[model samples]
Target: MTPDLVLYGYWRSSAAYRVRIALNLKGLAYESQPVHLVRDGGEQHGADYRALNPQELVPCLVDGGQVFTQSMAIIEYLDETRPTPPLLPADPAGRARVRALSQLVACDVHPLGNLRVLQHLVTQFHAEDAAKGVWSRHWIGEGFRALEAMLAGNVATGRFCHGDTPSMADACLAPQVYNAVRWKLPLDDFPTIQRIYAACQALEAFQQAAPEAQSDAPAAS
Candidate 1:
């Protein structure tokens, strides 16, 4: 069967990973259109893809002939259109909390460690891979410290980021945690985050959305 939805993304992009998790959680069928971010100076920069997303970023979703960019926006669109399994929450306060948590990672932390930012660090500032790793770890750790406090203190945080079911916050979190592990950041200080991440991983939605499980991911050694 042909899928009506198409997702253009790089396998390892955290932003793209968030969209993948959201799609899986919604039980939506989509075709993976891999855009190699590293090879050939990034296929995202190509004329065709840039037309779809002027920002030259991944996780561009095409649904019913309409194009959508930005991971968070796309997730919310899905939620609004589907609504069977809500990504936000029913109450206004809960919705705000989830969005705040999502942005804590997406806006505050993930941007510092983004591929383009790390590349600029190398080109403009002569940063080595070790320096980039350090940079990533520092920002991720700072964010996780705050995230841990928020999740730990909040009674709303249950098995997932909010209540028992996973929400947009969890969709945002799992990817950042993946980045933390990639940078070799220690998880000892974030027991709540670690626990929630473990819970997310046990779900089929997160399992299928993992970077390693993506079609564009390299073959296991």
Candidate 2:
């Protein structure tokens, strides 16, 4: 049986964007099924999407008679299955460093500023747009500060997050930086992140995965 790799995701979603970068890095061709996040009160929470992923998260990868959720997990699965273009490091220590960097953005910063969390801050906590922007900027700054310190103060820093070539950390960093720009956060503090972002943006893969280049992204850009 031929394997099916359909990504059910929204274009502007950072998590989904990360998976898109990984797929492009691996040079895999798959079906893109856009799941609108906000229209009709969150279609991701609809019964149909929930049937595929109970967690109701975007970027669900349907491959080889199995379903995979979580952006990091799906990306790692792709790296494992298609090892020609490796996403991790050859050494265990290097792999750990890359994963740590990626998680600092994905697990720590992303959850705090995700759509649902931000919406809750607005609707439940009565946070206005300015307050929400402050909230997003605060967490992004915190994560980027630590990430900059790690990158600038360590020898692991290279042309990309792990090396001269793009890696998982670079994929994670680009999307987070994009979100920070969206919320109007100043990038002057994180020189290393900005430098890495510039390098990643020069690549066709990252450029094509950008929110502005996607079909589902808003016209605000």
Candidate 3:
């Protein structure tokens, strides 16, 4: 049976972006419910959305009768349930490596530049746009540097992060690099990551999952 799948996400969210890539890669058809994270003091903080996700986070996936929060968890759930065009590799070691790469962006780089953290910087610490960009670029660059080394040095890296086909790591990497480019961070030094990103973006799945292609995407953005 095909379960009803609805993704509640903000168009610009890196977490949500990763999930979008995952859904496309798995050839899953799902409805997108846009959560405007920055409109009118954030829709995610509203009573209804918060009730749906106590964490008040974007990128919650409602699958059939189950409500799932967190992008990585939702992605893994999709992989486990669907099983074709697998997001994780077949072997345990390969899966671990992919997961490690995924976490490099999702867990480490992303959190430091999360919407709330950026909002807090402005509201609590009075950080300007320049400062926020600096904060975002710093972590993104540092993380990408390590990721570049991992990919450039490893024989495991193929057309994608793991092999020729896109995996969870590619899903995670595509969005973070998108954010990096948005922030005007240089990708010249990370040639391997840049090359991988270009390859991922060229695919129809990734192109369709792009932020600009979302219904909730801004009129001018």
Candidate 4:
């Protein structure tokens, strides 16, 4: 049975983009309920949204009357139910490798560089735009440099982060790459990551989830 899937997410959120990619990859249709994180003092903090997700984070997935937070958890639930367009690998080792790569971006890089964190640095710490950009580049460069080595030096790395097929790693990588571009980070150093990102962009799923293409995207500067 097809469940009622409503994704409460912000257009620019990488976490929300992950779930968007997963849904498209699985050929599942879902309602994209835009939750503006900045406008009107962050709609996510409002009583209505907080009722849905106490943590008040974007990319909240409501499936079959059950609300799920965390992009990875929501993607795993979709994978468990669908299983055709598998996000993880069939083998345990391969799955672990994929998850590791995914975490390299999601856990390590994203946490330090998300929108909320950037806002905090600027508002709370009185950081200027230049300082925020520096913060972004510092972490992205460190993370991408490490990822480039992993992808290029390791034999397991194929066309994608794992094997030839796109997996959870690709889902994670694409968003981080987008963030890198937004911050104007040099991609020349990480050729392998650039290559993988280009490959992922070729797919319709990634294109659809791109922040610029989202309904809530601000008019281009």
lDDT of each: 0.96, 0.90, 0.93, 0.90
| TM-score for each predicted model, relative to the true structure | 0.99, 0.96, 0.97, 0.96
**What does candidate 1's lDDT look like per residue over 112-134, in tens digits?**
99999999999999999999999
Instruction: Write the residue-wise lDDT of candidate 3 on 41-97 in tens digits.
Output: 899999999988999998999988689999999999999999999999999999999
lDDT score for candidate 2 against the true structure? 0.90
In lDDT terms, which candidate is top?
Answer: 1
- By lDDT: ranked, best first: 1, 3, 2, 4
Which regions in candidate 1 have their CA more than 4 angstroms from the true location? Answer: none
Relative to the unseen true structure, what is the C-alpha lDDT of residue 96 in candidate 1, on a scale of 0 to 100?
98
- Candidate 2 weakest lDDT stretch, 10 residues: 1-10
Superposed by TM-score, candidate 1 places the C-alpha of residue 190 at a distance from the truth, in angstroms, of 0.3
Cα error, candidate 2, residue 156 (Å): 1.5
Per-residue lDDT, model 1, residue 207, is 95
The TM-score leader among the candidates is 1
Cα lDDT tens digits for candidate 2, 1-221: 33378888898899999999988888787778889999999989999999999988797999966999999999899999898689999999999999999999999998899999989997899999999999999999999999999999888789989888899999899999999999999999889999999999999889878878777777886
